[model samples]
Target: MTISSRVRLICLTGALALSVTSLPLSWPNPALALSDIKDITPAPPEQDPPATPAPAPAPGDDEDLSDEAFPVIPDPDPLIKPSNTDESDATTPQEPAPEVIYDLEKAPEPVRRMRQLIMDAAASGDIQALKPLLDVGANQTQVPLQTSDQDPIAALKGLSGDDEGQEILAILLDILSTGFVQLDKGTPDEAYVWPYFAGKSLALLSPRERVELLRIVTAGDVAEMQEQGNYNFFRVGISPDGRWKFFAVGD
Candidate 1:
């Protein structure tokens, strides 16, 4: 009689209708009255599906992901090593300094002297002698006795008179010919009289004969002769026969 009782009654009626609708035609054999169940047959069972192949494993799957995956390799000891790279030898190897060889036969007088001076300086440990000779090829302005229009080498040819003088002359010849002036000029304090001449007379000598003539003059002892006239500051004299002959000192 109330709203709750009415709702319950409607639900009961809907359930009864659904049950009746879903009922089979017969109680036990629903298709018993059908002509043939075989004629209305079900489809045959599907053959078992072909087996699918498993996918191949990715590379390095067996490798460990842990910190210990790859072993650390220590560097090989240098002492015991042979290498895939270039292996350096342990022996102390030396490279020789460049050497200059002199040909005594073909050597010009100047070259011979240059060699001799180098040898003598090296022997006596008087290396200062080497400087002047080395300067033999430089300009004449450096020579103390340099004259206007006079060739430096020729001037040296005119001066060298002894063993020391010859050495100086040789240096002069070498420098004049080679024009290679890469060394120092020795000081007068070193008593570099001959070597100094060689250094000073570089680039002045023009001929082999001039060198020979200079060698003769340089072989003498040099001294100031005299002040001949107003313009004549006399040094060592040249004779009419082209010899280096000292004259009166002050007359």
Candidate 2:
């Protein structure tokens, strides 16, 4: 080739080398450019900051009420209309007063005679004196003794602490002295029972009635009878016809 053409070709080659050397070593990648674009884009409008959870309720909140917590309501008083013009006038039901008799003169002739006879026998202080009066079979005086014993005198002795039965006689006198009540009036069972307390309720006893009872027995005895709801002491029962119905203890 000619020298001029060779020199021109050499200058062209050196220019191209200098231009390439002046450029940056790292080349811009297409994938890196796309990643940078994604990073810069605004995040989808921040979706209303994920709803915050509601605060918990305080203690005893939203609980059911118990039956015990409610106040008790009492039943209303019964309706009572006033009998008189006065609104405060109220009448309450009361129990009937018991019929009590202290005098023996009010009794029939036969009863009085029989009572006198028994009193005389008891005053004698001899247990045998009562045997004649109690001799009638099936109609004998009903003494507090076992059914196996048929003899009234022996039964009296058994009841007495001593062999002569003076204690039983004393008890008989004490029983006959107390107030009496005539039960089953006009009926076949009509009889005068000594010590009216036997058939009467201890709870309903008046102050005077209690005094009469204390005459024959102690306060402790009345208290015990009150607890038991009945009298449990010796008593005598005589029919209107003067027949001795019973001479026994217990209700």
Candidate 3:
């Protein structure tokens, strides 16, 4: 035979031997036979396109990534409103400027004249200007409080005759300037307080004991003023005719 025919004959013999070797030699369980077993790894199912992430750019393609390939940032949400987080900021409602029930221009003639006298006496420490107002027509009896060393609330004029009388005058002026808020007569607090120094209106009281509050507050006004550093508000007590009974620093 020729070389080509000999080569083909040898290949055919090898394939027949391999096929015979692969065949089962003995009988086995029919349920566990090779034909009965299914493949554990089925041909890989086709992958879905949506599950894949977008490919990142190559290093050479990263030209000034900050400016060109800018990171996507979410914009502010439209549903929610921005809030003012600062506690000290002025955006919060400021205390409504205290309503001035009495100002220099709006005050009655008697009150205006009295204020002028007090101002002059306080400025010059001269009781002479205060003498006319201190007289009985004014219903002001210039009685000495005889309580404190300064006796600020002692009399209408305080100690205007003395050098430090300016202090007392200022206190009285602050009291007069305080706004008036009418007290409810039906209230039990107002009823119990009616017997003392008869006044129709209430002056905000900072003291605990309302019994001698009238006298104590008069003396305490000076201390309270010194402590506060400013006369922003005053608890004012006035009679039906508008005569001030006693005034003290209050809300």
Q: By lDDT, who's the top model here? A: 2
The superposed Cα distance between candidate 1 and the true structure at residue 21, in angstroms, equals 27
Residue-level lDDT of model 3, residues 61-119, one tens digit each, is 85545744787687978886656657435466644323324344544454445545555
In model 1, what lDDT does residue 104 have?
Answer: 46
User: Which candidate ranks first by TM-score, i.e. highest?
Assistant: 2
Worst 10 residues of 3 by lDDT: 189-198
TM-scores across all candidates?
0.19, 0.59, 0.27
Task: Show where candidate 1 strays beyond 4 Å.
Answer: 1-44, 52-113, 125-128, 136-251
Please provide, for model 1 over 56-164, each residue's C-alpha lDDT reduced to its tens digit, 9 standing for 90 to 100.
6688567444558766678877886565454454555654322212234333454345445544653553334435443333321233345665654454435555434
Order of models, best lDDT first:
2, 3, 1
Stretches of candidate 3 exceeding 4 Å from the true structure: 1-100, 104-106, 142-144, 147-164, 173-251
| Worst-scoring 10-residue span by lDDT in model 1 | 225-234
Superior by lDDT: candidate 2 or candidate 3: 2
Ranking by TM-score: 2, 3, 1
Instruction: Give the whole-model CA lDDT for all candidates, comma-separated.
Output: 0.38, 0.83, 0.45
lDDT of 2 by residue, 1-251 (tens): 89999999999998999999999989886566654665666667656778889777779697555669976688887698456656456566665655888888898989888888888999999978887777366776788677655577888788887888999898888888888889878898788988788778888888988998887779999999999998898888899988988888887
